[model samples]
Target: MEIRHFRYFLAVAKHRNFSRAAAQLGIAPPTLTRQIQDMESDLGTRLFLRLQREVSLTDAGRALQAEAELTVRQFEAAQLNAQRAGRGETGHIELGYVASAVFSGVLQKQVSSFRLRYPDIGFTISENLMPVLPGLIEEGRLDVGYIRSPMHLPEALSTISLLVEGFALALPGSSWLCRLKEINAAHLQNEIFILPEQISGTLQVAAQGGYAPTLGPQPGGLVAVVALVSLGQGVAVVPESMVDHIKLPNVVYRRIQDCQPSSFLSLVYRRFEKAPAVARFIEHVKDFSERPTL
Candidate 1:
């Protein structure tokens, strides 16, 4: 009837003697005998035949024994799986990122290292614009996020700076900005600064460098912004890491000289998270950030 009944049946079947079976079960022989009798009464079938010195299994007893063994094994396996999931050893983790995170290469390296360490954990990654990533994390659409700074983070979200990098101007290959060896805010005074439709961290960087840059059309994302820059539509300042993502031959990235404003790559997650996997991932990111980099 209950799992204990199956256990009693198995112990008796294994030992064959009531006294020995009860001893293995840490119970008295009389207790074991009564339990077996109760199980048989509940099942409406005799499970064992009592011989002169030992007990032998009847046909029904053998069948029930086989089924009980499998059932117990499966139940134990289920319990173990639940525990592992609770411990964050096995579960799904969704990670969202801005384009700069990928360009920085830290996000990819951190993910690879985490996967190697926690192979049982499942992961999914999404590349989103800076403005949406924090909301995605807060709304539970993403477990964690990576984004560039000048972020207006909600109270529910927490962040850690992974790296600090300077901004670089993405220029048209034939533009005069590319010809200047050392660029300053003065050089960009008359330039049209292409900005993404979403939140622009570069605006803060430009502000810090004392430039009231002329605004260009707001494109969809950094990729499109750079594409527009390649067409000589305008120039754009982005984190240095993002230059790696700019593959357009028509665009050249130049570092700002004299007064370049720096930007930070930060990892963001929800506060008071209940998922152990999310906590583990946050810890991994922190640890990765602490290590020395060349």
Candidate 2:
């Protein structure tokens, strides 16, 4: 039966007077009577017994009334939630970040802006490399990953360039690289370089000077890299995000000149089947960025 039929029957049953119910519904008396008649006919039962302008609900009307009220309430609730989701209000976002974001503030700012706009959406963050993250995102275990560029994005994956931050030579406070106001590629040729194990682009860039320096690929994690450099184990090329953290007590950071390759950063998401909330969050980020202000 039509929803209006339920509304009409309930109003008439509640008022117990055809004229009063018709007026309350802002419908003509004859029209209200026809609607009630139609509902009773459709249900194959007498919903109301009319007598001298007074009405009383039949057995079926009472039974249907209880269920109809619940249906209407549930419908209203569903509509409210849909609206909230559309406005990017209620949902959850699983985000992944590589080591660079840990030092650079760009990722944090993007997330902060998104949270401010969509406060109801919870944030779940993961810090990992693309070799592992790509599979997780494709499997729906992750919503998005902040990964380094030069990725082999499959057809099942999509991405938007987030930032292209150049690598700087990060060193110990007393190291000689820190003393150079401007670092030339040749300066790094003889120093031990600490780069992430999964970063091919970083290795390629540092190789431009053809240093063939000692390979200090610290596979453990960012902390290990910093610790190694602080103790003068070797020099590594790190992104700016690492600087955002409290500087490693004895570590120094400086930009490199005549670098072979640039550092490219991107937000990676599974293509074609991303959750709706993920798209909404990305759009908010793009909008806020173009607003001409930080």
Candidate 3:
């Protein structure tokens, strides 16, 4: 009839005596007897054969015993899982990111730390363009995103700046500029610049050179932009961290002597996040950022 009824039946079945079962259940023998009688009436079957000293299970009681044990175990397991989810100990997070986030190592460091703290929380990570990450988070398709800043964001999303670094020039290995001991903005005045999703760094470099850059095709990701440079299609200005992580054939990274434009790797999430797992991750990011050292 009810979960408690199943539990009472199980205890009585285990001990084979109503008095002992009642003692184990912290209830009087008469109350336990009445509850078992009520269960038998509801089921319309006699579950036990009562003798002068002890009780023995009927055919129906044996049939119900296994099912009752399974039900009680499953019910208790469900309650435990619910409590863990409420505490942000077990759930899944949908995470999106740009290529630079991985290049900077901020994503790996922060995620690894969070995993160590909440091992039961799972993650589904994906890489997306910078422009779409905010939209994904806003639309509830993604729980959080790692992206580069200096771009427009939706009103419903908020970002936490995680790492700040300058830009570097990605050039064809055979370019004459690579031969220069120190390349300045003036030397890149007439070069065609392959643009990545975030163009602010390239624009900043051109603005400092006192001339408009010869803008080229805008690619989707950093790897594609660097690949174009490897083929001698054009040069690119990318996050300084890329110099260390993105090593493609025929593409050389050079520091610009004249201008130092900053790029930010940030974590973006919904302003009002409802999922406890996602909220816990955002809090972990905030805590990781405030630490004196990573």
Candidate 4:
């Protein structure tokens, strides 16, 4: 008839006395009797045999008892899970990122800190191109993204700048420029530039050098661009953090003396995020960014 009826039946079954069950349930004995009677009437079967001193379960009552107990426990568990999800204590988040975010270590630090605080929250992490990350978040395919800054994003998406880093030149170790005590933008005027996902750093270097860069292969990720430079295909301008993280053979990193172009590693997500776990992650990143040590 109702969940309360099942509860009343359980209490009575446990005590084998209406007076004791009513006391445990904090209801009048007559009310508990009527509730049990309602359940029997709804099911078209007598669930208990009432004796002068105590009550005993019928064959139908024994079967119903097991099912009712399971149903009540499942219902209570469902309610608990829903409350935890609403509080951002447990849920799954789909995260996307570019290679530079991992190279900078900002992604790992923030994720590790958040995981320590909310261990029940799960993650599905993926690596994606810079331009594709924002679109994935906007399309609801991804909950959050870590990407480089100075790029266009969909109107529905927003970003928080996490790390600001300068660019470095990845050149062939045997190249003649490596012999120079200090290299500057002016010296790379005629050199071919291997392009990564973002070309702003290279363009900035060329602008300062007073020459239009000879743009070379449009290879995609940071590692691939560095791989091309290792083979002497062309030099690349990449985030300075890559100097420590990427150690491809035959590729050497040099700072451009005359120009320092900055690249930002940012966290991107929907402007109006609905998932509590994703929103909590965004807040955690914001807190991490504002710390003085960062």
Comparing candidate 1 with candidate 3, which one achieves the higher TM-score? 3
Task: State the lDDT at 81 in candidate 3.
Answer: 94
Identify the candidate with maximal TM-score.
4
lDDT of 4 by residue, 165-188 (tens): 999999999999999999999999
Which residue pairs in model 3 clash with each other?
none
Identify the runs in model 2 with alpha carbons over 4 angstroms from their true place. 1-5, 19-51, 56-68, 82-89, 174-182, 197-201, 257-261, 289-294
Off by over 4 Å in 4: none
lDDT score of residue 135 within candidate 4? 89
Report the Cα lDDT for residue 86, model 4: 99
Error of 2 at 111 (Å): 3.1
Q: What tens digits encode model 2's per-residue C-alpha lDDT throughout 1-294?
A: 777777788788889988899899999989999998888788899988778869887888889889988887777789898988876678898888887765666688888888887777898897876578878888888888877787687679877776667666668889877767788777777777776644554576557777566787665466677788888878777666666674787888777777745566777876674466888877765675456545
Model 3 has an lDDT value of: 0.93
Task: lDDT for model 4, please.
Answer: 0.93
Question: Positional deviation of 53 in candidate 1, in angstroms?
Answer: 2.3
Model 1, C-alpha of 54: deviation from truth (Å): 1.8
Stretches of candidate 3 off by over 4 Å are none
The 10 consecutive residues of candidate 2 with the worst lDDT sum are 197-206
Give the CA lDDT, 0 to 100, for residue 147 in model 3: 89
